[model samples]
Target chain A: MSLLVVGSVAFDDLETPFGRRERALGGSATYFSLSASRFHPVRIVAVVGEDFGPDQMRVFEGRPIDLAGLSKVKGLSFHWKGAYGYDLNEAKTLATDLNVFADFKPDLPANYRECDYLFLGNIDPVLQLDVVRQMARRPKWIALDTMNYWIRGSRPALDAVLKEVDILLVNDAEVRELTQEYSLIKAYKKVRALGPSTLVVKRGEYGVALFTPDGIFAAPAYPLENVFDPTGAGDTFAGGFLGYLAWIERTDVTALKHATLVGSVMASFTVEQFSTERLEQISQDEVRNRLALFSDMIRVEDL
Target chain B: MSLLVVGSVAFDDLETPFGRRERALGGSATYFSLSASRFHPVRIVAVVGEDFGPDQMRVFEGRPIDLAGLSKVKGLSFHWKGAYGYDLNEAKTLATDLNVFADFKPDLPANYRECDYLFLGNIDPVLQLDVVRQMARRPKWIALDTMNYWIRGSRPALDAVLKEVDILLVNDAEVRELTQEYSLIKAYKKVRALGPSTLVVKRGEYGVALFTPDGIFAAPAYPLENVFDPTGAGDTFAGGFLGYLAWIERTDVTALKHATLVGSVMASFTVEQFSTERLEQISQDEVRNRLALFSDMIRVEDL
Candidate 1:
């Protein structure tokens, strides 16, 4: 199954307890594509700037990723500056330079119009809806990710796109904020009322919780001794989740549960270093071994 | 196997988002005994006051619990006034009047001294150590629970008791505070050096994580729509954990993992209502059913 993601492609300045990186390859689509590519082909529909060079292109070299929809504009790329303390769960954004991204318009290539799986990354809700409308036909499954910014500032636009989404992914706080409900089950109910039948609530270090009509499944994050950076953990998690579903080509409870675990396993690797450094270097065998380890960590059996 | 616990027994005035309870029976030992007695015979060694009446005693009636060591002092019983907001994770303490508890001393009964399993609930570290010393012989297993006050105020005493404890259970925050480490894995390592071979980090709402010589096992809390009060959840979790171990009489990783789920099941019921109301009325069948449900929530298997 073909997967398409529409979001930001940016350069980031990150400072963490472990180290620092300037102008590192980042963005929602970047992390999502790299993570999803490990499972299936990922087609990126995001705009980059002239500053995105061969070195950055090499990061995706030899990978099954299509960049036909990656538009290169004249202005600088989307750039962000963030820092993290000992508590790696939250990041403090110091600066966000949307330069070319501020006036961005996602125009998917003809080849990407019929992707079986679609992931609308965190962008303006209006833009997200526009991408869905431009799809040659509705994808088999459409998962959308939004943030507090759109949830508060563009409720109608967000709701408009949410109606077209089959799956929704948001962090724990965003879900509560979006629904104005502290209880996750209640928030999930409200989300289901809006549109998406499946909601994956991402709890950075705590793990991820999946809520569907069948029931709820909660997966714990892999216990790590050190978390170098947490910049794109959420997007990487979304990629892994949707990517696994695309590869397996199923949406049943069992498949969703496995996807939830696979997402945790992918995000666990993302936080091990700045940007997609760890994601770019991890082997499939390592991912499977960690998934097995996580299974043991959460498994319960009778004597 | 007989289990013995030495901690406070108090009367609580509570206010939560759902409702309120005045002069409700509440305390570490009270919740612990009520939860543990459901699985095995529990012996409580703690001090009360003249105000303690037959109605208060009825909370423990017909349960497999020994109250012979419940001392009635001259002063009033320990009283606590607390409130909770929509975020049921933390409580706001308005007042705490430790009248009789201030001058309390744990005096174990003859029969209680040789209990095969012993639990030292949250109390003065000195008193916990004294109870450990008074045992006729070392119990088959010894578990201890402590809090921030003792961790910050009585380091030497707490350290002395930690040397003799086979298992230690404390909330996530307390574990980090005790070792001054922000990372849970690092904190668990520091705790291992302190002498307790097994450390159970009780994360309310999020779930429980057990760290032992073998490895780690994490369990997710049962997702609930209504959480009335969360006052004694940690103590109740401890009671369920030690009680299950006492019932099975095993400390293997599998047993410990099952025990972790049982503890979560017990704690889930404790928060359904204020004080011991829910714990008192729950049937063993309900507990087992919830345990099975929890296993289904966390269990991961291949498709």
Candidate 2:
């Protein structure tokens, strides 16, 4: 199965309670590609610039990710710097250099148009809707991740995109913020009314919850000893999630539930180090080990 | 299968974002008995004063709970005043008058002495241990709930009690504080090393995690539209948990998991109103309704 992911591809400087790191290979597309590549061949559509180096390219070199759709524009790549407090859940943006990313017009490769699965990472909701319009054929499943920025500033565009996506992925707070509903159940029902058949609420370090018309299933965040950085954990979650769905060739409620578990396992690795440091080096065995942990963390006797 | 609950029976004044109530029926034992009575006849060992009236007793009067161990002493009943912020998760104690509960002693009724299950509510650890020693027959399972106050101020007594208990129930922050470990996994190991066969780390609103020698299991908090007041939610959880065990006539791991579900159902009701207002008026059908909701909330098919 082929998977298409569109979002930012850039560098990040992040600091957390565990430690700090300088400009590292980061961005939504980078983490998404790395995580999704573990399960299926991924096609990345994003714009990077001159600063996008060979070292970063090597991160995805041998993987089955096609960068034909990844553009190398002029000037510096998008750069973001952020710091997290002890909570490690909320990030304060220190700086953002959009660079070439400011004019990012995701132009999917001709071959990418027919990908079986699509993931629109956190970006402008209007742009996300445009990408969905560009797809040659309707993918088996289309999942989206969004931020408070769009939900607050571009409600119409977000609502437009929500009406088209098969799944909506968001953090706990953003779901509450978007729906103005404090209770998750009510918020989920409101999101569902917007058109997505499935809603996945991401709770950092806690777990993920999946809401489908059929039922609701939740999986706890795979417990970790240390969280070095939380940047891109959400996108990495989306990568593993959609990637697993493509790998299994199923988007039923059952597959979505299993995909939530896979997403949690991938996210646990993403937080162990800054950006994609830990995620880039994770092996299939490592993924399997974490999936085992996920199973153990959520296994309860039938009551 | 009789159950014994030893804790305070008090009057409480509470304020929440929703509203406020004064001199409401509240306390660890009050919530515990009201919830546990659903499964088995609960023998409550607690101290109240003249201030404790029929209005308060009415909360438990019709339930299958024995008041033989409830004592009324001189002066006012233990009085507590608290308020919850918009989050409804954090409680700020405005006032605490221990009153009769300050110098109280738990004298288990002769009929309660042979209870197979014991739930030691949040109270002085020394008093908790004293009740254990006074039991005519050793309970098959003894679960203890504690807070940071006792963990820091009464470590020795708490440690002694921990050695004698079968399970330890505490909040996530309390577990982190008690073990000085940032990760719940490490915290669980440290807690298990202290002697309990099982450990439950409760994350308010997020859900609860159970760690046993065999593995880990988790259940998300049953989502609700509004939380009027959170007082006594924890003890009510304990009551439902232990009560399920007594009802099933077993304390095995399977029973523990079922108890966790019952606990979640009970807590969903506790948060809906102040003190035992919602829990007091809850019916068997209401319990089943919430149980079905809990089931719907976590139901997921394997990929």
Best by TM-score: 1
TM-score (all chains, Cα) for each model? 0.98, 0.95
Per-residue lDDT over B94-203 for candidate 1, one digit per residue giving the tens place of the 0 to 100 score:
99999999998888878888988888989999999999999999999899999999999999999999999989999878999999987789989999899898999888
Per-residue lDDT of candidate 2, residues B161-279 (tens digit): 88889899999888888889878778888988887889988888888888888777788888777878888888989999988888899766767877888998898899998878899
DockQ by candidate, in order: 0.68, 0.60
What are the clash counts of all predictions, listed in order? 0, 0
For model 2, how does the per-residue alpha-carbon lDDT over A61-125 read when each residue is reduced to its tens digit? 99998999889988999999999987688999999999998898888778888877889989998
In model 1, the runs with Cα more than 4 Å from the true position are none
Candidate 2 lDDT for residue B202: 80
Backbone clash tally for model 1? 0
Off by more than 4 A, model 2: none
Could you give the interface RMSD of each candidate, to one decimal?
1.7, 2.0
